[model samples]
Target: MHWKEYIKRMPLEVKQITGPLVLGEGPHWDDRVQALYFVSIHEKTIHKYNPASGEHTKTTLDGRPGFIVPVEGALDQFLVGLEREFVVLQWDGAEGSAVKFVRKIGEVDQDATKNRINDGKADPRGRIFGGTMGDEKSPGDFAQEQGSLYRVDGNITRVADKIGISNGLAWDLSAKAMYYIDSLEQNVRRYDYDVDTGDISNMRHIFNFPKNGLDGFPDGGTIDTDGNLWIAVFNNGVVIQVSPEGKLLRQIPIPAKQVTSCTFGGPNLDILFVTTSHYMNKPGEGDPQDGCTFMVTGLGVKGHPNVNFKF
Candidate 1:
């Protein structure tokens, strides 16, 4: 079905849950604690929101923490992708007191000064898969493609290289396919996935987003129970739902122009929690809810539980 048809069939109501963040991204919903965790990378802070009580908790980090995923079988432990390395962090106490710094697990680019880890998540087999991007320092200046995607299990291995702004990562329900996003390419690619060995192969372009049209470059995404891909279009203020065949199924409008990333959360896994950023807008200049986190309710679809990093 066309995106307009899907939007007409299922009109979604978008509501803001929090205030303006510097650059809000990386949303991870913990079903066990019934809380949603996300990050403001430019602010160096981690936020935890309890939907039932409308209670919000914020934790300060040392570096630019890009993404955070729960550790497998560990309630208080999490694997975080910091600026140049991956570290283990622990949350203590009841009210989200302080973020404890644990040991360093791995580093992304120790020698390179411009490259940093951007986005990543755990696969079905409990291994963390992530990517990096080259820093762009000036306006209209494209950063060199020095980034690469890495798989973290017992040891870190570079799986793919020559990347520009690595963003989204997701696996199909059958664990036979992997979806990845390279924002600079403005396209989504599919690869044959090996669940047992944690290997990806047979890469092919599935969707090429139009640069001049409504859809911008794809940023972050998650998969639903119906085998559909819900991807955030950066600079487009929309999250589009697409099928495995790369057909646009639904489009959700957000309040902010830089809609960074999204995930499925809430008790029933029915809530489509989204994150936005105020990258180029000043305070009170753009949309009032530009940098706030949004929750799109009544979607009638449940998302797969996020897998934890095992090693």
Candidate 2:
């Protein structure tokens, strides 16, 4: 609402498929395959949909594909989240899929009400980083700030010492800056990221949403071509476009109540692909559009290509 460069948008194309996904979120566009990849947390599946042809494929993975990053030279290799563990999946087209356990989570008992894998992304240098929440079975763990952010190299994974639901994660073009959101705290943070070493430090809050009668939190988000942050507003039925400096640009309204994550795709990256939820919708105040996929066209916005899994 503060930046003149941004504008409101309508959901150009809204599609509600049969998968009554528990919590539909995390959207990644695969340029090579000309498809969009996303996941539903409660259902524990990865969905592949070709935007051009509307062809959809469902892959029930071992753990939830909290997020996805392609393999550099291999059409099969993909880095994804499997519950609290991080796995490298090899998609063999018609041959089905193969998975390698890259990082194994410890036996930390999370509050069934509070612990789940939340959001993530790969650094330009190819290391994997993701946020965690109390799994669907353990939500109490996060309400108490038990879940934290994590990082993994080849074999070792480091748990961030302190933080609440590590929700949003994205990388800038240079890979030198990383954008993040601390959901419970209601703020977006930035850090000096080292692509070569996969080290993140110098944390600072760049954006903090106003408690302006909004019902939800700023969940998952991505950095745009102009370095602005496009964040999905959970429970608010909208997405907020914020400048790198944390100034509100525009509020793109949708018909859903629980908007989870968003990403920029399309040939020129002008389209914004968004995912949503209906889990916590109150009765009588519901919008049927919840749990559906909405497309935002003519955003004139472009996003950075997701970093591929180097291993």
Candidate 3:
């Protein structure tokens, strides 16, 4: 099929799942349960939505939850990146049961009053790697760059420092390259990664967003089967796909202005689940679909299975 014909039949219409969340972010899919998991930062709640049955359930957490990933070797558990630390969450009973905090696995900072874990993902090796951002104020009155990236295996260790709004984190198919986004700098960077040791070096710029084109910065993202990075442009009202070599592919339009994050879900791993935020919109300026979880299909692409969090 021709390019235009392919685009015409792509089925870009997105179906809204749940809505009006304070700051909906971090979409993850669990193949075992056939459910989608995400977090609402300000609300401090973790949402579990079953796309097949349209059953949505949320559990309140003590602090702001940034991201959640499935736990390796344990089908009924998950690893949550909270504002101050990483904790294990166990399902109360079965697939739709409530979740409860199991234990604090690792912490980002001892102070825990300023910075919080923002976004993260598990590497191919099952170690959960995430980053922190200055939420309330800078740590010890430091600059905004005080935020840092951390790798949480059995303990939390700082991977890199001087980060601002740590967002998208993904590894290439080879597991030798890692792609990261620090929204403050407006650039997605590529780093040489040591898959076995979880070390990253040789940082280089991959793609930088235009200073004025998009309304907001880049947020969370995931890699497709083709190795293209699909990034949620916060205020641009779309998700942009870029090739590994830093070439633009296409834009997937979103109804919400502040798109927060996205991941692949559904049984076939062909559905793109998108999360949006309404905190940036005025009382009546937000779209009807704003702050809702959206599902996009017929994209002609599939996503790799999510990596489990290694203990």
Candidate 4:
């Protein structure tokens, strides 16, 4: 079926949660705290929102944050990809609270000073998997193939290389498959995953954006309980849902032009929280909701809970 038909059948109810950031990305829902955490990379800030109370709070950081994930045992501590380093951060989510850096877990691309960590997540076993992107000369222009993907399990190990704008990642536990996206490639690759040892192999392209008549590159992604992948398409203003077999199932339109990433949240994990970017928007240009975080509902699916970083 065509994407337009899918949109017609599914009338998604989207609501803006919080707004007008420089670049809003990396969304994670903490079920334990019943709150949502996300980052605005260029603004150097981390935001927390409680759905129940409609309270939004944020703390500024010294460096740009790529992603934020909760720590397994520490409720108040988190593992953040800050610039090129993976560091432990402690923030109590209080308004006007200060964020303390505990220690640096590791750093990537030390030699490539221009490269920085981009997007990341923890595997089912609690190992942190993150990727880096080369220098961004301008919007949609980057130093190609100077980045790599890394697995952090106490020690940082390079899993894949020759990446340009390394982006989305999702894992299917039942199928032992890992889905990855290098945004510049405009395609999604599936790898044979080894859950026990945190290994991935036998990579093959599963979904191609241009070939499938899609407009933008694939960005951050999350998996549903049924193993379907919901991918955010950067510059496309929509998120596409693909089946395990690589077939497009639906396309949900977003108001913001630069939709960066998305994840499922809410009490039942049924709400899709989308993050947008205002990276290249000039003063008084583009939509007013360009850098807002939106909550999408009415989709009949539940997502797996986010995995916390063990160390």
Compare the candidates by lDDT and give the number of the best one: 4
Per-candidate TM-score against the hidden true structure? 0.92, 0.83, 0.91, 0.95
Query: How does model 1 score by TM-score?
Result: 0.92
lDDT of 4 at 196: 97
Candidate 2, 1-311: lDDT as tens digits: 52223433433454453344667777877777766777787677777767787666666677665776666777756667767666667665331344445444332224443355677776667666786765334322235466778775665465464556677788875547888887777788888877667777899987766644455788988878788889999867888888877788878887787888888776766678888887675566566677877777756567877666565
Q: List the residue pairs that clash in candidate 1.
A: none
Clashing pairs in 3: 126-310
By TM-score, the better pick of 1 and 3 is 1
lDDT of 3 at 187: 82
lDDT of 1 by residue, 1-311 (tens): 85335534675689899998978888988887888888888888888888999988787888888898888778888888899798889985245477888778888776677777888899988899988988767522547677899999999999999898889988994748999998888888899999989888999988878833555679999999888999998788999998988888888899888888999988778789999988767555778788899999778687989877788
Q: What are the per-model numbers of colliding residue pairs?
A: 0, 18, 1, 0
lDDT of each: 0.84, 0.70, 0.83, 0.91
- Cα miss at 15, model 1 (Å)? 1.1
Q: Which candidate, 2 or 4, has the higher TM-score?
A: 4
Across 136-248, the per-residue lDDT of candidate 3 in tens digits comes to 44222334786889988867888888897889988984747899998878888899999878889999988888833555688999998789999999888999888989887
Residue 117 miss distance in model 1 (angstroms): 1.0
How well does candidate 3 score on lDDT at residue 83? Answer: 82
lDDT, candidate 3, equals 0.83
Clashes of 2: 18
